[model samples]
Target: MPVSRTERLLNLLIALLNTRYGLGRGDLREKVYHDTSGNDVAFGRMFERDKNDLRRMGFEVETLTDTGWAEDDSTTTRYRIGKDSNRLPEVQFGPEEWTVLLLASQLWERAALGTAARSAVRKLQSSGSLAAVELPAGVQPRIKPAGQAFDDLVAAMHARHPVAFTYLAGSTGREELRTIEPWGLGSRFGQWYLMGYDRARQAPRHFRLSRFTSAVTTLDKDTYTPPPGFNIREELDTLPELPLRTAVVRVRKGRLLALRRRAADGKGVPPAPAEETDDGGYDTLGLPFRDPEVLAEEIASYGPDAVAVAPGELVAAVRRRLRAAAEFSASPKPRYEFPGAGAGARSTGKGTSEDQLQRMLQLVPFLVHNQGLRIEEVASHFGISRRQLESDLHILICSGLPGGYPDDLLDIQWEDGRVYISQDLDLTRPVRFTVEEASALLTGVETLRGLPGVAGGGALEAVALKLSAAAGEEGRRAAALSGPPVTPVTPAAADMHGTVRDAIAGGRQLRLTYLSPQRDSLTVRDVDPVRLYSQDDVWYFEAYCHLVQGTRNFRLDRVQELEPNGREVSATVPAAGGSPDRLFTPNNGDTTVTVQLTRQGRGLAEDYYAERVAELPDGGMVVDIRFGNTAWLPMFVAQHGGTARILAPDELGDAARHWIADALAKYDG
Candidate 1:
């Protein structure tokens, strides 16, 4: 018999044991060799090899003594797992959970270890615990093939080989053949990216796997060396294509504030209102401010309020697109005829409208007060179809407000067709930011509130308010307060922060407008944004700057422009390992410190330190902190004066002493 036949016999034995609760030797032989009656002919060296294979594959087939299969009364010859050998835990499955499991298992089919997931399913089938569970036929999921390139790429990644391929740039439709030293694979925002070192550029880059045309793996493994001082996270944020020149156009009233907020905070903000300029023109916006075409639809939505404020070429592009849209909408819309309908509006069946409304009303009492309820149960209770229930829900979301929103009495959180409701909502309580929270909000908003493909000021403010209310009274109050006045020059520090955060989270590179005091010069550099931190009331981007050829800190206030670089970054760039200590360069010779922070500054320390607490004697906190760069400490001490002191790094102590002496000398003068 072939090896496949022998494997099937073992599977057959397990299945028979599960079905009969225990199988006799006669039954096992009959099932294993259906052609032979009462005959065990397949017992040879080949059979021993099959048994050994089964053992190697984690099965516990062994001799048992309880069945009385042996001639002697005291001995029995049977094969089964020993009672103590069942190390696998029993798991019970439900219909829905089982369906999900089956769907997830399909993902393994595309992987190199596809056989393992199938084996797992086979074992589950043999386990009597899952015997009663049946997944419905309608729940069968549609499986899409993962394409040849993705499979080949994944295999190459696992094999640790260099792959040369023609990669399609999704945005450009351009193909380039390049060799890459693969590092890792990650999925972000519904797209797959292959991280590796690009031999052509000799830098770390990430390529979208879906865009690769043809790829072949070479036998060479680990031949590539990542560029020295390269950081992958930093490289991700500084893609060249991602750094577009973004222009934010705020609306009337808090428009400038919103624009500043959007510029300062870089996560996407809600779309700006459609604006009409004095000349009946419109303003357009997008992230990285590089491509206006991507946000053409958004600009069109504003009707006319949107204005282009930067990069003359982008403004012209928006105008040209607007002209094209104007010409397109000028064409008449085509109409379709139904099978039996005349030109007039369709009529509802007799008495159907009242019945539908009554059914919807029945759902209101339960749905209005509850956060969530099952769609299936609700559909059954109301004698309604799923389609009808969904249509009613759409109407309900817009129904409650006295006029529109604030007075709206209800809201819904629809998840997988399940409805969650928030009732008796007060609209007048617009999302408010507290002084400190507003400070943080303004900090976040200034950078992010205006970009396309992101949430804007109005949306952010509402979300912030919702979060604040959920956080309780103190948070609400704290959010209500505003921060002290300090003017950051054009484009604002807040905008830089938002862009950097977006770039990091989006896995795109960043191009920053940096200003150095050496000369009043604006330098554009690509960087991977790794992390953001604030010290002494100032925000800075700790990114791997391609210009400096290393990781460096760039002050938010000094940044001129921050945009997403959509191009691939090298994945072979070594990650900035260790801790935040990596931020301090060797030439700087910065050190970590332990500090006693007064009650006020303790909160500040808590924000930065993972481990921070107040010690009793002085009502201050003992905090361990890393000052990657020491120059900022004196300014920090001066700003939050009386509440903070340097607790460690005796070198910092000497610096403080010198600073105090300088101050005393001024008094002597």
Candidate 2:
């Protein structure tokens, strides 16, 4: 009753074809091979089956005539679902639509879609039914979950129980274990959050799901109760009125037309008709969101064309931040002086390199005007190849004007095998880094240079030099390390890393001097090192230890020496499960859980196990959480000491009771 690999492969192809605008036979082969991790023969077989499967599923595939596919005696197909050609829906957006949706989800509010919705949209777009459509008003409502925490929350919500999680609060470096009842999830401001009743604090709390870690579900029934106390509908229904600060502005009717055009183009909202005002036919600009300082600054930026008429408060606030900024700017001694200004002063113009400026210009032109440049064109222009161009571009695109989203200042658009630029030119001036900035950048570059299989150490050194030049004298001060910094490689670590990595990747067995808990011992062992990772400031190799015939984690630091046995691993290994970094490892103990009831908790318990009959009252319900092993139970029970109580599972109950007794015994006087 389980899906076979071949079936999964066929399904994956079908899914891709269904959603894409259309895939030619050759295109399908390429994509399948690439996405399947270079399984060419497997891809071909799956591709062949996909055609047959499509016909069986009632899709009308159009065969392209006089195409290479026809020469090979293969049908060149384009998927069409409709039975009647006249009634056929159009194929819409292609990768462009996918990219736009991705960006819109990040930028605009609420653009999350179900997997099914994504598939449908992809299919419609790929079929060539849709073309170059941007979301209306440049905004669409979509939901983007924060991460796996949200996925777990969804599973718990379906299970209908109070969920316990360690939540990181805001920017604070602290975590708290809180139990909450389930509620609907929503996305806002590019982050997913869960709003629910907090039982411990007895308040309505909202948590950003991204910061949630180590989530666990409680089996306790009737533990959560939603009070009629908070009326969500009433809260949402109240729309606050926007307070306005009035401002006066004179516009030549033509200039007024330009202002309207700019505003409409920026916001996709048409401005109202220009009307005559008391002072020589000036128009009134009533700005919303009463930050007078901001309004004044904005008006000032309009130069003499705009003037603030009333509500002097707005004007004053704008002057405050700006005046402060101006004062701060003027107070600083000049970094460089104009050549004629002073004999001893440093050069005043911020020295940005010609190459840096050209790079900045290239990014904007390629992303916006070119819709994205051809990889070949970029390579040719830079005197490099496509791969090198892409690598450099990715690094540049990632760096931006400091601080937050939309701050990225650059975007790439890919269309017709070319890239176009989206944002304005950045890095026009040479980048200057302070002592702190230069050292930080240098440290990053140094670490990256030490990474295995990474190339172009020269490029990293160049970036570091640019940063250093930007910092001038200040960068030198920041680079001065108080204590020796922990470098990534000290020649020793590099050699070890190289040897270990090569051995693992090559599937060769190793003989290592392993330090166990008891003592250091020389042992001969064979392992299929599945993954290499660093945990808690120590490097570890997770491998299939042949001695135990199971997975084990061996500390790299504890490794006294490693020698290759030159014997290749013969048996295959199963694909590892989820990234161990994000998932919990089974601890050497049992965990105990208890049930406590609030209206919401009870609702959750029922939801979790609706099919399993349970005893309940008219208003409350009961659920149970049991652990077969009692080792971890005591600690679990102690964390939620107030709400949870050990019941039934007598062994865990006894363990919890014994733990409490031991704690009290220690303090007994």
Which regions of candidate 2 deviate over 4 angstroms?
Answer: 1-419, 422-439, 446-463, 470-477, 480-498, 512-525, 530-537, 544-552, 569-669
Best by TM-score: 1
Candidate 2 Cα deviation (angstroms), residue 73? 80
- Residue 662 error, candidate 2, Å: 6.0
- Model 1, 285-400: lDDT tens per residue? 23333344444333333322344544444444444434433332232322222223231111111223323333333355446534456787666544456776887776555444
The TM-score obtained by model 1 is 0.28
Relative to the true structure, how large is the alpha-carbon lDDT of every model? Answer: 0.44, 0.41
- Least lDDT summed over 10 consecutive residues: which range in candidate 2? 104-113
Clashes of each: 79, 76
